[model samples]
Target: MVQKAAAILMIIILTLTAGMAGRQENEKEQPFLVQITEDDPSIAYVLVRMPNPVGLLPLPTEGEYTRTIRQIMPDGSEAVNVLHLTPEGFWMEAANCKGQDCVGEGMVTLENREERVLWNMVVCLPHQLVAELITREEALAMIGQ
Candidate 1:
């Protein structure tokens, strides 16, 4: 009788562990957010959320694309940055800033954001622009979405 109870307990524990693992996997699949801000108080901020890839599609879709963000400075100069997004991660493909430091910041992915030097943000100080990777909850709170 005791042996049967132990077997049942083992089975329950295994099932719970498997369920937790599946939940973690689903969380991993959720999309991340990107917030872009211009230092100038006159210009409005921009927040872009990366879209999750469409499932089971034979061909590629909006899940991967290049987004060009242009911010006009008070002096009428334009700061341009090209952001590249993939299912795996996102990176600054190109920037028109003189320093070009943002381009060198490399990729920010779910797997590596924590370990990165800047955490989840890339900054273009010369242009007074910042691009940051943020969680969905934070994004919602910021925009009241």
Candidate 2:
């Protein structure tokens, strides 16, 4: 009976320890300062601004992910844009615009979490599309929050 009790105690301790470790890992992940999205990338972005455009919806600077968006802007214009998120930064892979200006905007990323490196814009006025790197503070401001 004693041996069985000891094993149960050990299992309980191990489970608790694992749970604590997982909580710590979760704490390390901070909230996103910026978001790239089709819903609302945020109008507060100063580097590039458009009334209402679409495509290439991405969310924050996180793990590797790819997204393709086709947005119909307020002007009835449309665009298809592709976006990529890398550990190094965010980049534009493709954009269905006449000038293809957004395609050349390249990657906009940070050297470190606090470091500001790239603040560029990829906009195609004809298609009413705009993609740009905006600070977290700027993003919050655009929505009036």
Candidate 3:
């Protein structure tokens, strides 16, 4: 009985150690992808699907208009966002967040997708809202290389 228990424990220990090592290596190798930015013909949009009932509809990237996005939280709280889409980039017109961090993120008008993939993100944490921007090449790669 003692030997059997020792063998089981040894297996468990080795399994846990291997899992942790793999996780560390995976984290190091992972490349960060940008999550959100204004509409651009060359860029692809990634909208995260959460428990939230509503989502943003796709709009033309080459137009000039103010888009309003209303998100009602699961807890019955309300969050509102007014966004302006221009030919150059996108920016927040107004929001109802406590910190206004999402509105303060400013316009994400990056021209270089290769270099800015990791930095372009618009996160409204309080409202559980996030937007991600992926390049056209990345989008194609996601489908199939």
Candidate 4:
């Protein structure tokens, strides 16, 4: 009876350990998406799915890159914004719009999205541009993929 009980306990322990490991692996496999939308007649749209890191270490830093979004305002003027993107997060690098509030919105990342004032979105009111970090499901639905 004692040996049977010990064997059962060991099996349960192994099962639980395996379950935890699978959960961690699934979390690491999950990926996030970034969407940039410009609400103007020109209507610029961009959707980027960031790649998941391999193992525990990050997917290496490539020094950061920028995507320029341009829109034509109703007043016949052009609005421009440069968005800085990375595997970990993104932020508004520069903008030609007035007020400069979008640049102050700062980076949005998976880890800090909940704590951020704007959550997952950075808005440029003057330029009518919005950059948001969203889940894969939401992104797929948006693009009808």
Any idea what lDDT model 1 has? 0.52
Q: After the best TM-score superposition of candidate 3, give how far the Cα of residue 55 lies from its true spot, in angstroms.
A: 6.5
TM-score for all predictions?
Answer: 0.54, 0.47, 0.51, 0.56
Model 4 per-residue lDDT tens digits across residues 22-93: 443333321222232332221122232111111011211445556655444569675667777676777889
State each model's CA lDDT, in order.
Answer: 0.52, 0.49, 0.50, 0.55
Worst ten in a row by lDDT for model 1: 51-60
Estimate, for each residue in 1-145, the C-alpha lDDT of model 2 and write its tens digit. Answer: 8577556545533543444454434433221232345565333232322323211233433456655444444565645666665545556688777778767766665443244233455555665545665554555555445
Task: Report the lDDT of model 2 for residue 66.
Answer: 53
In model 2, the Cα lDDT at residue 94 comes to 83
The residue pairs that clash in candidate 1, if any, are none
Task: Using TM-score as the measure, name the better of candidate 1 and candidate 3.
Answer: 1
Per-residue C-alpha lDDT of model 1 across residues 1-145, encoded as one tens digit per residue: 8577556545533543454454433332222222323331211112332111111101012356565554445576756677666655667799898979989999876578799998776667776656665544454456455
Which model is ahead, 2 or 4, in terms of TM-score? 4
Candidate numbers sorted by lDDT from highest down:
4, 1, 3, 2
Candidate 4 regions exceeding 4 Å error are 1-63
